[model samples]
Target chain A: MDADKHFIVGVFDDEEVLLKGIGKIRGNGVKIHDVYSPFPVHGIDDALSIKRSRLPIAAFMFGMTGTALALLMQIWMLGYDWPMIIGGKNHASLPPFIPVTFELTVLLAALGMVGTFFIASDMKPYKWPRQFDLRSTEDKHVMAIDLAINSGKTKDELRSLLRDSGASEVNEKSFE
Target chain B: MQVASSLREALITGGKTVKDVSHDISRHVENKPTKLWWAAMAISVAVMAYGFYCLCYLLWEGVGVWGLNKTVGWAWDITNFVWWVGIGHAGTLISAILLLFRQRWRMSINRAAEAMTIFAVICAATFPFAHMGRLWLGFYWVFPLPNTWGSLWANFNSPLLWDVFAISTYFTVSLVFWYMGLIPDFAVIRDRAVVQGAKIRAQVYNALSFGWQGGAKTWMRYESVALILAGLSTPLVLSVHTIVSMDFATSVIPGWHTTIFPPYFVAGAIFSGFAMVLTLLLITRKVFKLEDYITIYHIELMNIIIIITGSIVGIAYITELFIAWYSGVEYEGYAFYNRVSGPFAWSYWSMMTCNVISPQLFWVKKIRTSLVATFVLSIVVNIGMWFERFVIIVTSLHRDYIPSSWTMFSPTMYDIGEYLFTFGFFFTAFLLFAKFFPVINMAEVKSIVKVASLEKKENASH
Candidate 1:
């Protein structure tokens, strides 16, 4: 809860400027917090040293939940609850379960993933966002650098690094 | 050096400002429809009206208006239901499954296909509801309702009940997926609106958007929600058709009672659905002049899927035949033989040629890229897939058990009327979609432009 944290933002016209700026910023031994662009910039993750997303793991877990729920639901309904012979087939057959199981697996996985996504991303219905620059959605590219540590020379160094790396506009803001 | 120079060249040449992309898409939206669009819309509307009239007739009278009998109870109604449902699958597959795979080509056509999925599912749902004879009691299909006819419970083992659950689930999931994709594009339209009415529409859109600021948090949440939905939908989409397949596979009929039906049905669903997508995209891309966004690369990718799924269906056909022979069940064996060589041999051959042989042409790049060839092939695939269902349901049921009960079924005017009306329902929804929301996912397309920009950036560094 550092109330006096400062953020340095570098705006770029396109991805090339952003990439070049990233290189220079990282080259200056400044720890890059995050880079925001209108769309995904390839190689930005590697350049910014960001780790691979854990969303897939979440999806896998969701899929597993779906699979388990589907199997158990079928087992309970067909095996234990009022089991009746269908088409003279065995009561405990797995083939009939395959279709619903597959469907449920997909259903559970999808619903679980969506739920996790909303929770992780903090998106909810009708929530108004704070501090938005509309052009970012349109076309403008932006790179934000949080200045949590280091002031004075380090601040100047980061700003000059962004400028030298072809940032069209550099702005600094104090966060509450 | 050559790569570097080429990269630099591409960067310079391909650097499209935000204004350019907006201008390109807006140009299409702004321009009034040409003569052809008017002609097409007029024809579609006429057909749609006729369909509505027929539907009204069906609704007023009973489903007895159609050619369905005790033996062929599931005739045109079920066939059209399954057909449209199968057609609905490709849109979700293209949008959700392809999104997971990070296929950039999906950006151009996903919106249209998703729209088609909603419309087609709407079309598909009408039949079962209407055909229920007691269309007013459609709510009884869902659980937790006390049956008016004593203490009878909905049979859990019944595939029909499974179908109710499946179709309703599929419809809900697909609607959410379609609407979620629309939010950003709606925001764009909202921002760009100038006219008073348009501005009001924009305000409504903004309200619907829930004040999306498109911040990192918003994007992150949107992306995650979309991904989750897509992941959920992928199986949901697959299950819908699989459940539809179960309606056949779960039965005791000779040709229908096979374990392979689910996969086969799913494959056929994708095949027909892609065909429908191709058909719509072909017309849309040309009419809307979305050639740049829905590039030949996208078309080629769809073709590849069409080919693969078509082949999977072909293999399923062979497998069905093989399993029938292998099972040594005389009725099943005869069903297979009768399908291939009986009085309905023409239908079987048509299914084989249209579905199996036509898609094989995609193996050659020339055929896959050719619009005419692809369009014809898509039509063929649709016809073939429809026949596949028809052949499976009709041929098997026609001669079941006794030869004396054997009957040849023909579609009356009512059957054709119901069928045409479903098309009307589908086209009307699509027409409304085009008039309102963007035919392309603008945000997703913007993302692709970003990726292309990144590619150019990489080359510049080299």
Candidate 2:
């Protein structure tokens, strides 16, 4: 298991350096496990061939749910439950309902997007975390590639590739 | 000097140490006496004291101290309420709206704007609370509160009740959003404090920071929370101003009754909010010597928003005129005509020139970038916006359906005092904000600076 877990991680001080390192790692035919940085590095997802985020789909579903809920709430309140004539206008009027509908739509979409983001990212409070490097949160950019140790030549090849591609540091790690 | 060189070299060599950040921020904090801060604080305190005095008088004498009468029941008090609420909009817009847009320039100005929002809301809240003859029983406005005499249920049909709910929600949400953003930055300061007393205070701050270690997981959650809050706030902000507009539109007042009020009010709120943000940023940037962080690019971006929102408001004005004429109701038609050529025509023209004409200058990059021009324009936009509310309330009320009720209204000395006192309420809160909290989102700004460096490297490689 340990032997199969060998990974080569290349660290850079900037996005350009990270991008160059990514190109070299891909050139050497290594599968990238992840690229971690302080903030989102645009285009890195494409470089690593990661799938597109599913947040928007979730937002749409939630928004539809919100619309349904808003309509149901208004209908129940105005149509059946203790209907009062406001401004001598119809109780089930759509114009008056627009403001509440709009508010609920946004509220649900926002909450849904956040929930999906949390679930997909596997983030929760007070959990023990895997620290790649502390300085990644401060200023450094790191790109990590997972490779099979049994492949024999992968480690040296990755080291050379990263060094040649202007990686500030290259290190190897094994995960259980 | 040697330390500075080494720091510069380290940054260039891709070893940009945390020490550099600590040194730069701390040196600024410790070295300066903040003369402008003292001056501003002194003036704000005086204004606040006067406002408190006015409030006391108003509380003692009753709501009659103001210029409000039978026809114009809502005058300067409600006008100021809407104005302050409108001014509060930009803060959330800067922090939440810009965050969602992935705009980096938002970092420089967001802290001040957020602070401004909170302060402005405090001022806005005062008018409504005091406007109630029995200010102590203000909680009665909220429904579901039981009373001994009777359970006075808030009219769910009334937009005023909606205003109460909307404003309260906006205030609570903004406070939470602003405080959440401040936490990590406060931790940064906590980690660097050298003084013993400062260390104790830092510990308190660190605790309040919810033990943020800036770990990957923490960043993910923080970002998620911020994004969610921003998303929530976008519509929430719009709803707030819309509800405020409804306070007028739901009424039978010919000039105030229009479907256009919601969007018109929201656009005007954003326009005025951005203008106020610009006004605050101009002074803060100069006084704090934050020229590099709050670059010309940030000013230009704010100007662009000002221009866009200003144009939206201008269109609303034209639409209102067109609708008034098109509707063909005599009272409505006369209301629009009176606004253009009535006794309060000067106020209406001021609103048009200040809100519509002044912001048009932003279309020219030269004027947008010029600090002097931006500052003057910001003040003008604020003044014009105040008059917009004034014209809506005063003009429509002064000449209502009953011509017998037609009476010219002007603010008395007490009304003027109350107005001036709101400045006091605003500045007092603002002074405390500047003293206690970081006026800039230091963590966010650090991240932007890092990205800028990375971008520079990317460009260099190309």
Candidate 3:
């Protein structure tokens, strides 16, 4: 592993219980490393106070880029380079340009946004991720709290806090 | 939190927990392939092999091996192309369009629909590529790449060129959107594999999943990107079939030159698309024992869409006929007349019955909800849509302005083989998808597990 961290992880079977537990844990001002759920639990993001994403803005910019590139390529090709008069239609026209323009616009937007998402999520193909709890991907939701960052509470205190809040299992996890 | 209410139906039934949803959906992936899976795959490969043989012979013997003649240039190949493209449309509509609309019922079906979209596009693309006798050069020529022939650019005005761009764009977008949706679910499967001590499965799914940490921050971005992609794909879906329709509508041919082709083709695309989805889902649901997730509610909702689109197609057909007679052009009028009374009258009636009359059966509650009825009608609708394309392409061309060049088309064995080959290819790909990946969008299904209304009720009661 390129990086390592010590963490206290809590696993909960029920989403409702998990939500309540998240609220309780976050209420104490304990910094949460991350919570992994099999599904996107409603209100979990708000509970964790995660920041709103800026991906939509990225998508718009990418889309604009696509539109500009499409128009530029078409104008360069049809208007200046190898312009032909077929069926008496205009060599550099607007209607015929729309389809290709639309296609390129969509293609670039999709590709660009996906690229942006991978960057934003730190979801590179080569990165080896640390797993806090394997069951987090199965039936349980996992909440991992970094032990090294929190100086106020002892490990036992956080472990009891996890147990009191309905965690099925509270375990210490480390990635080396 | 969601209770199955009269007004707001639960998207997933059996009141499944998130784990149960994961387990239920992932069971197929973790276990070895079933006997039925093997049998179906075997048949698909055999059919595909035959189709491949036909394609090889086509390459060897040339385009003349098919029944295409001077007058009727585009026949079974283009018709199959359009048919398959139309089938691909329902997938995007289910995923992108329905997502935009917030139709929760799409959760269970969207995965299969999107997969169908990819496979169907693959099938649809084979025609135009193979139709080019010089498949090698013609494929490259269709693209607007700058080459040694620097001054020679692809004709911007050509619908075929537009189609080349449209199909590829549609394929790429759909692939991204579908794969993006799969990432989180892949992580879920990966976690399970690790627990089971399956080293290879864990590593493969781990990499495949992009090491998704399920962080709230990551999910938010995943969601935002999904919405944006959906927005991009919605217009894209409409444009794709519209460009396909333009291949005919832009022409001077009597039956083909109609302003209504875009909406008509789009409507028919959705119609056949839903039918094909239904056809496949019915088999998939039963074979996989996924009745709880893919409930009658989902089937009926899809059936309702089929009815609506089918009627739109029917109205378009009548409207085209009305315009043909209403337009006083002899060529257009005779073209409509020829479709009804030509050598292809059977194809025309089949189109009418399958596309129009048959889907009307879906209007009935019992028939629409009935699995057998939906399955048969779905296949029937597809057959109708195919013949509909045949009637439009062949009828107009067989007896156009130049009567001397008018000729009836009869498909050679290779044409039938090529069409069967697509069926083989489509099923083989789809079955492999079903076997390997989570068929239902597990993450999405988990999202809808708690109904908003039920949550509201619980809060109020509290």
Candidate 4:
């Protein structure tokens, strides 16, 4: 059997217990594969030591690109290509171009951030996800420890560790 | 669990657990549609069909069928467009602006509000779409597309063109923000289906959820995406109405050429938007038995917002009058005079009473908290807002500088039918959404209820 496909799953009843349990299990020198919950827990990111997402940076970059492209298109199309004066205002005037520019900037930033999120989170239509416990999408919090990742500990050892950490139930799951 | 402050009332009442939240919300989507839902839907569909027929007839007969004359070129079309667009604003205000402010009360209402936003915007788009008589042939002409006609491009300078970009961007962003929030909620329904052995339900929701796994990392990224999207949408919502107001403000017409139009229009939009939200939510909470989730406190808070925005709109009306007088431009002065005492004075007065005066009655606690009062006032505010747009468009355009060209604007059956068309479409789409989707944000509500449940336990021990 592939050890990497095997996981020691712990079902949690309360987020408070699950949070403290995360620190305790980590301190015991057992690495956790991941935690899953129906709703976002308040401090799970800090407990997991997950880095802050850099999505806003991506949004800003996409916004700047939108701004530049809108300006360039307006300037080229109106100033050089078509060259018709509207209300005798100067061709490629920046004042009137501001509204569309701001709109496109926001448009690209929003769409680009969502696209990045879909890609980074591996979410898409027709992609079946690896659900460790069905209850994680309902009322329970779930913690999974890969036996391969925690090679220092045996399956029985990790299962008991999960129980001691206040898990309501402990079980083993494997993927083909 | 997060600590709850004793100083504030619980946003959601009725002792509810996390499990209860999921069951209560998802049950609506999982079950077959109720008889009332089907009946409402049937009426909406019938109205929509009649409206669709009217639209087709108008399109075939052309713009002349809508009572447009030399003096009054724009009438019910632009009025309904602006009215629907204004109604659409409350959704983004709740989902994005209130989210940024850390208003936990918004959690219960935002999902339905955002859905209303999308439908209202769709309704709003029909006006401009129908206004372009040759829509099938020249709809793409509005976009900045490169074409064989000498590579001719849309004029970048016009406010009308700016409206094209602003509204499309607004609709697209609102849709994404709303759908992203729906993903986790869809996962909730999918999991319940799995437990109940409902295979088709599970399969459908799983596909709709994009097979969400609810992992720690994915939830973290989801939070980040929500925050940034909210940030993007706040400014976007503001810009949409501002550009729309500019469509009138940039023009040389005396009444429409005020510098205060942007802020004034934005305030009126929020005022009207909140009224529509209250109207819909009051019925929704009643029908769905969601009184605990959407508590009386939510109604009071929404009423307070209405009072504030309504007063702002009132001041804007007075300010426009003041500015029109102080500008000392005779034509501008006459525009205000014509609004008060002209042939269309009844519409102007109806607007004043409905938009400016009616909302002030909410300052009383009794009326503000009363559901019957709220429902009646909500419809009152929408009617008033519709007249607000009508007064702005028709009153300004009907009496031009040249008296010989001045004419009174009247609506043809097609015009009234077209407006009804939007109403039918709005209700039909909204009813379908209410049936098929989770009307409440189950995921967010569950998180908040954890704190509430914990708070209850702590109080019991004490």
- Top candidate on DockQ is 4
Candidate 2 Cα lDDT to native: 0.74
Off by over 4 Å in 3: A1-4, B1-6, B452-462
**Candidate maximizing TM-score:** 4
lDDT of 4 by residue, A1-176 (tens): 45569999999999999999999999999988899999999799999999988888989999998999889988998999999988988987899888889999999999998999988888887877788899898889999999888888888889889999999999999998
**TM-score of candidate 1 on Cα atoms, chains taken together:** 0.81
Task: List runs of model 2 lying over 4 Å from the truth.
Answer: A1-86, A89-176, B1-33, B194-197, B454-462
Judged by TM-score relative to the true structure, which candidate is superior, 3 or 4? 4
Worst 10 residues of 1 chain B by lDDT: B1-10
Ranking by DockQ: 4, 3, 1, 2
| DockQ of the two-chain complex in candidate 4 | 0.85
True contacts kept of each: 0.23, 0.07, 0.78, 0.86
Lowest-sum lDDT 10-residue window in model 2 chain B: B1-10
What global local distance difference test value does model 4 have? 0.91
State residue B429's C-alpha deviation in candidate 2, in Å: 2.5
Measured as a fraction from 0 to 1, the native contacts recovered by model 2 come to 0.07
Candidate 4 chain B has its poorest 10 consecutive residues by lDDT at: B450-459
DockQ score for model 2: 0.11
Model 4 quality (TM-score): 0.98
Ranked candidates, highest TM-score first: 4, 3, 1, 2
lDDT of 2 by residue, B38-107 (tens): 8887898887787778888989999998888887788888889899999999999989888888766687
| Chain B TM, per prediction | 0.92, 0.92, 0.97, 0.98
